[model samples]
Target chain A: MKYLLYCIFFSWGFSLFSQNKEVLYGLDETPQALLLNPGARISNSFHIGIPLISHLHFNGGSSGVSAYDIFQKSSVDINTRIINTISELDDRDFFTTTQQLEILNFGWKNKKEFYFSGGLYQEFDFVFYFPKDLAVLAWEGNANYIGKKFDLGEINTRGDLLMVYHLGATKRWNKKLTIGARAKIYSSLLSFSSTDNSGTFETRISESGNNIYEHLISNINLSLNTSGIASLNDLEGGSATNKILSRAFFSGNIGVGVDLGATYEINEKWTASASFIDLGAIFHTKDVESYAINGEYTLDGIELLFPPIGSGNSAPPYYDDLIDEIEESFSLDSIYNSYSQMRPLKAYASLKYNFGRPVGGDEGCDCLNTGENQKYNQSVGVQFFNMFRPKGPQFAATLFYYRKISDYLTFKTTYTADSYSYNNIGLGLVANIKILNFYIVANNLQWYSNFAKAKSVSLQMGLNIIIDENK
Target chain B: MKKNLYLLFLFTFIAFLFSACVKDTDFNQTDDIALTTVLELDFIFFNINSQNFTDLGINNTIVSDTTDLDFLDSEIVSENIIRADFYFRNTNSFPVSFLAQYQFLNDNNEIKYEVIVPVQAGNNIDPVITEFTEIIENNALVNFTMATKVVVNTIATSSLNNINGNLDLQSKATYYLRIEE
Candidate 1:
């Protein structure tokens, strides 16, 4: 039971988290916001992020169960509460975690209708599903049920540590249409994944024999894929910190991706926008390790008897016999090969209606509203986002209200419904002082009141230097 | 206006720190649920056909029957079986021991668990039952067969049908699950 329990953790070797940031998408208040939709119009002529402090994000969420499920001070015992929670959870329920740090970022409007931006950001992403049947058998002894096959396919998970270098350009034809595209190069530092395993393990009594019940592990075909991690994890493998750090950019194991977005203005108060990101894949062909088991074996409680040694006699291969029997019956193979994983493609679309002061109206040119200084005092919109997760596509729909309180201050709030939470409330604010700009956004504010009951939480903030040509 | 801008920046940063998702949650980590049930095998209809009880100069013959045991659990359990408790008795005066064994098999027709209960032969035909719990090596249970075979000690003189005997069994099952807060 202990060994199997250990395997469950080692078997979970993959991560169970996803990427879902609905509150910050299409906000247009922060330079980093453009990462979600490049076509978003910015009044600032140029901006430079303050290095490491430019953009920092941390978010994690769990669905199907929460902290309240296990840590709550209840009348029931801890184990009782746990089993009760497991009973309610299914395979579709998952846990998600994501963290991204921007190291270099800058954008400039070379012309009134054209703009350019680029940056380097290192990101760690992980997502995995809990294998319930495998967990139950590892914890409980296989005793009462003489014959039951526990599924091996329940083990499904994926995780990666990667760095991305990107450059983007936006073209604004008129006040009516703005389109942008971004190209990204991804370098994977370390990764491990083991999803889609198949097989079963069972126990039964011998119909005719001197032994008790026979234990059988049959038709086992499970595999674990890894990269970079295997060589570093090896104590004698010889890997230097400086050498590994140098490979962070332009590493042999690299992938290319792209992001495309467009914003179209239908009228003075109506607008529509959409963006697609990370549409590519990385192929792992170097420093990769794969372990697989593809065979079956059974044991009939055979007890080997060792007789006392007499003079002039040789020792028996007691342990050798067992090893030989098992080796002959089961096979474990380890190989190094190449594998490819698609980037978690993300997309967002929104429809908005702006109401407030119109641009250039004071100039008596009401016919032309397109300019570098079109300010809206208030706006409301609905946005939908989708990300390709390891399990499947995950979607989030948000309804938002935004306000420009002053010339240098703006605020936004959104109500969103996603896989994690339905009553997700988010708040974002952007403040401009002189040439220094700062913005901070947080989601699932209600969960802050009771951290233990919280299932999901997210926060993003950044600082940048901006120059508004219009001002 | 300058003071207000600073205040807004400070307030937003402070709010972000408070609602951040910082706590780490461990999944399926608790170990404390165990359940046990009985598997009763009543020899309701044991009729010896001519193939098993023929008097055609046959010195000895072995007769047996295998019945499928049902484990009605919804959630899939592991094969890391901690242990199994076996209890059964011989309630017949047939002299020879009644060999009973439980055969567990997976979908691939592979035998995972094969347990047998040996009833000792005494001078007096006794109705004695024995019980013992042994740790199982298998981690999962899919299906099993309860088989009974009789070894004849006497020379074959006549053929007879309807061999009767009663065997009872009870097993305790325990599994661990976790509840995270």
Candidate 2:
């Protein structure tokens, strides 16, 4: 049990990056870029992803403390290292992970120049903030500190596993502006959250009381809510897979959301785009379970009263009575309540300055070449991403240089600064072979030499078949 | 130009793959992990009025009470408790000094340990306060866990027919535990 606890603690505490895909944004050759910004221009007339192999992404890491900080070979004792690490880590430090797999994806452009795209994808996201007061209380207890209060509000965490089915359309309304919107239907498989807790536990010296030390549990309002978990047991057997597949296909607790995006051309030399995704909530009405504990209690030991002589009565069970009083004061209440959870909304915006010679030497007069179709061989841009979290919104800024090396290959490199690290470098590559398009993106290149020390890392890759209109 | 571009792309991809490498780390240090914690908790207390003793027969000089302490028998306390310090404060407002004897017994009602406190005498306007501290560790701590009950006896210095005061007792315990893998 001890090993398991430590293993889980250290594994989650190791280096990680948040769920922002900086490298995939603004790359014109890859169709996956449309997922980041629906208004993104694509020269292809139609495209089809190869089933589950279309797109895969994984990003996770902690903002503070890494495996090397404690497990690195050192002469100091491990216990001291652990203590020092705990002391240095604050409540604001958080661990987060986001994973996504594209099950089906395809898109097409109609005769009126409206680009329509849709897909179904599975995603899992989790985030847990460090509970500093609880860690200190568990490690040092209340013996050394006589009047310290452990804040229970520091315990904040949330996790969800769900499938999203989405469809979107993009069209150029005029010569200078393009706009798009995607409608989404979410099917949640499992979800749990424990947030907005408020409480404190403290021990103090009593000035005038029956006992010397007094213990107080004040203003406690803690709750945990879960959905689609209890029903998993009912889905036991070979049909469990089928049941889950069907639920993910749309039979589970469902909700609706939408993504809005736009691209604007200021002139022939500069372009700007912005997008907002996952602006929706999931209503968990089926198989929901919640528990709540609220109230305040104080104790000053068990008070014993001596019976009068020869009263013919045994001494009252003072200890048992105290236990009963405590149970009554701080009781756990099981609740069967339905609730709604908002998705983690994300916002992206970027500005690019296009220069250098246009691809294919701008020698042909083609209508499809008017927007984002390898018109410029080199460009410099800045991108900003923000995702709403339980604590607050997390933000990242990236400056990138995109180069179209040849007709069949292109690359983009980026330098990003966020809460995780200041020296994060990322790279993305897209290769075109006939009708087959392949792309890969990786982040945090500086720490690749010593990966264990890096606070965050992420990878994304995908493949698709596209047919260009000008072909 | 096309050949050079292909070669550059291939080289960049290989470099990206080869750049990720793990440095020196010793995960085996987890085997030596240990956590030491100390917890302060309220133990037992009481307030006895002198009338209870004065109501006794003219010759009676002592009164006793026994309470079951099931917490000492719990596995978590018995196994994790390495050392304990018990602090007791007694205030007496009676005319006569008293001897407070505490006897710890096992489940079968056998005495395992005993503690004696000498309480001072005082008047109603000025009560006497006496504090006692007991530390049990090593072999004594092992024997302490065997106790599941405590028998407290309050013995007056003499006949208690005219006593008119209160005896207040307050106590707490601090336990030191070392939990490791």
Candidate 3:
């Protein structure tokens, strides 16, 4: 049991944040850019990632209060701080996390000038929307909030653990346009989601009843679906670990998806690109469980209607009747049925203009470089990102500046505005020593002064081996 | 050599960022966390006519009725409740006064706590309404929680065989809870 708990805790700690690789976009030194937009032009003829270290990403953040708000040392009581924080948060606020690790990755450029890449990666994604009404109800109870309806619809959350195997091909279809598509196969290990609920609980003075007040639960429609969880309860520690590890392969619930991307060069200095990823659904069949409740019920206290004069009878079983009605109205049952869930789709687009002296001192383009116009050493661009979530689509915009500092070193800086914050500054570095490549990217640099106060953060780093055409 | 210098500078910056990134925070504040909640719930209610005071069509005084109410015996009520307030309102149209008793009994049928309410007489044309409140706290509150059942007794003060009136009773209980982590 202890081993299992440690494993679970480690896995959760390892799984951290969002899937947005904003810094890596359009970076041509390393092959990691291909993961963001497969059509992105690369300057290398071949690349192979160091297994399990090629791409490590962690991205997550809350749109509401940070941990410092509740844990900071202050004169006010901690409970007061918690209550104030809870009051400040709204239902639309959410916390989301995504983490991915590349296990195997390699690609080669063919004689036909086509780049083909394939790899497998494991990913974990989670999102939970803050339920303000529910939090108030639990903290203060209904005694003080008479007649106020607690909105149960605020409850919305989803999580998934899965592995993806993919292969993609990038083609410079013409001198002005490059297009690419990647096919993906997903193996889901575990999944759980409860969304789109509706209900209300209220207490009000009774209009006509034996009691002074009535308690009501009305218009309730809530459900939860999960896969690969119920069966784990019946297994022991080692068996459970084996089951999860085995499912990580292609033996678990399966799905398929495709990614499409394109880059266009309208003129010598103008460029635009776009990519759409994870547009597919997973079908959960084995070990599937679902629960649902829908109905309305009310309780206005038990009424003991006494018999009139000379009528020889006892009072009805009022308490029993109330219990029976409550049971009938809120009966929940587990259902075993297959279900399909669509992956959270993501989209990115950017427009950039290249300028500054070309590498090799404004000399003619490198004859051996077969990628995009290999003429610029510096560029500035604006990028837009949108990710579909359980609530709706979340958007972020960034303005970036990229520069090739030297033949072996590249640097990029960005300012971004997203739901979490408006003042997010990020930086990225890509370096190549002979055929060895390494890169590191991070955002929310200002929070490095006090990490606990930041609402969101992102970091990605990787190592790979590349072979240039000249080599 | 310039590339190596930049690489070295970046590595040192990253190490510095990690070494002193977060400010000091006291997570031990959780030890002082406590929550207080109040819940108001309806307990018992009833309505009776003059006929209930007559036996074999004969006028009878001091007639009584008893019913079982065991909600206060619940474990959650016993464990979390630090204080309780019982509110009662009675409307009587009977010519005779009345007495209402709430008897809280333990497992051995021993009365651990008892509450009595006295209602004044009223005429059939103008019903008299009366209210009563009982607040239990401290050691008395703990004793009240030990009750397994409650017996409510309604008694008449005089003959009501021919009294053409009704008596109505309504009551509610408010519990104050203290929870600590």
DockQ of each: 0.07, 0.61, 0.47
Best by TM-score: 2
Off by over 4 Å in 2: A1-16, A233-243, A309-313, A360-374, B4-8, B11-15
Clash pairs (backbone) in predicted model 2: A16-A61, A16-A455, A16-A456, A17-A456
Across A339-446, the per-residue lDDT of candidate 1 in tens digits comes to 988888999999988876654435453332223534456779999989887677888889998876655666788998888778888888777777888887777777
TM-score of each: 0.72, 0.92, 0.91
TM-score of chain A of each: 0.85, 0.92, 0.92
lDDT of model 3, residue A434: 79
> For residue A262, what is the lDDT in candidate 1?
89
Model 1's DockQ?
A: 0.07
Clashing residue pairs in candidate 3, if any?
Answer: A17-A59, A17-A98, A18-A59, A309-B51
The fnat score for candidate 3 comes to 0.52
Question: In order, what lDDT does every prediction score?
Answer: 0.63, 0.82, 0.80
Residues B1-181 of candidate 3 have per-residue lDDT tens digits of 7767978967875675455355655656666665667787777787888766575345655443334455667776777788999998899888878998888878677998999999887777899988999999999998899886666667787777766888888888888876663
Q: Estimate the overall C-alpha local distance difference test score of candidate 3.
A: 0.80
Worst 10 residues of 2 chain A by lDDT: A365-374
Position A195, candidate 1: lDDT: 76
Please give the ranking of all candidate structures by lDDT, highest first, separated by commas: 2, 3, 1
lDDT of 2 at A155: 90
* Candidates in descending DockQ order: 2, 3, 1
Q: Write the per-residue lDDT of candidate 2 for residues B1-181, one digit (tens) a residue.
A: 7757675775678576556776676777778876788999987788886666766666577777778888886887788888989888999888889898888889898888788889998778999999998898888888788898787888988776766788889999899987765
